[model samples]
Target: MKKTFSREGVDLAYRDVGDGLPVIFQHGLGGDEAQVADVFPDRPQTRRLTLECRGQGVSGYGPVERLSIATFAHDIEALADDLGLGAAVVGGISMGAALALRLAVHRPSRVRALVLARPAWVSEAAPANMKPYAVVGDLLMRHSPEKARRLFDDSTIAAELARLAPDNLSSLQGFFNRPDPVLFGRLLVAIAGDGPGVSEAEIRTIAVPTLVIGHGQDLVHRLADAQVLAGLIPPARLCTITAKSQYRAAYRREFRACLSEFLETLA
Candidate 1:
């Protein structure tokens, strides 16, 4: 069932389902709980909890000024505290992966295991890969939604992404079609420009078992970034899954298999 928890005056939404081996999984930018459900394996023995971050999904925007990865990480921390979970398997996709990594670094005691799926950032703020998102954000800020979509469709960025990263291109298109493009644009700009805030040295200090998933054909979440993360954490295991653009079915299957395999090892 869906639940709501207040954090810093914002009513954030969350889900606590199933009955054992609590796993705190999260969704990416412009994603909601349903997006997580699509890839998460269905198991009777595992309970999953996903908190919709501020300005995403059904969650309320709590102090819009505080939209960095650190803020989102703290929201997850607060969710864990509210649920009385001292430590659980923490993981996520894209921006969600960054949040999980941040928790593993700063709140190590609260992460039993780490699962980073399709990570987009490594150590620095505003990585080059995220430039497309910045472009979309700028368009939303500068022109009307219709005009922005028209402009983006005709831009070189769109042409390049259509040929190289169809999945990323599709996601960017969704931004133009959103009901609140302005708000989402601000969110995209803030988050795309923000990094995990945890340095490489700090990442090396993470002592828990970690699973980093990455694939090719994805410009936004590069496989190289995932490789770097896997190399940093001592117990991290790197897995390369099928790219979604190559085959959606295989991608989901491989994603679930990787997650299930890692979860079993933790058992």
Candidate 2:
């Protein structure tokens, strides 16, 4: 079922599916609930709740200056509270993972477990100015779908893009066009901003068991970062999948298998 909850005067969209232990799925920047559905479809015993962060998908955006990791974390807390889910397993991909980590740090009681898929915030070399792409993407999103598709395809981590199928590629392009252009730009800024620092100090404080998923060929969020993250968190496990090349195959099978195993252990 899909619903909306007000947070700081903006309405955020979310979807809940299946039935079991609550599991919240936070999508990456410019991503919506569908991304989570595409990744995990058969976990019927796990009640999945996927949220569309502010300025993305059907969610309404607030002031552009307010877009940041901390604000997003608060939005997640509000969504969880509205759903009557006091504590749930929280996991995310890319920017979403960063938000999940922040949620665990700030609202410890609300997160039972964590799953990070190709987390993209730990790098120091990420571009500081996203204005160029944001302007281009916003224009393409409204006027040129083909150009937008090519832009996204080219921007994806080369090793990861090689793994995706044609259909998955199409789905990704569709997602890019679903959100508002202005809001998407703000989301881009939010993603590029510094994320939560889950260092040894912070990791040690995290009581929840965590799983870090990485691809051997992912350049954006290198395997080394995953190793560092796993090493820092006492109860964390690292799962690495070998990718033939970027877009080679979404590594769907490996991702699901690893996630299932990790969740099973949580049980």
Which structure among the candidates has the greatest lDDT? Answer: 1
Q: What's the residue-level lDDT of 13 in candidate 2?
A: 87
* Model 1, runs deviating above 4 Å: none
Model 2 lDDT per residue over 155-212, tens place: 6432243464332234335544654654565466455654664444766677789999
Model 2 stretches astray by more than 4 angstroms:
123-179, 197-200, 244-250
| lDDT by candidate, in order shown | 0.91, 0.69
State the lDDT at 201 in candidate 1: 99
Taking all chains together, the TM-score of candidate 1 against the true structure is 0.97
After TM-score superposition, what is the CA distance of residue 29 in candidate 2 from its true location, in Å?
A: 1.0
Of the candidates shown, which would achieve the greatest TM-score relative to the real structure?
1
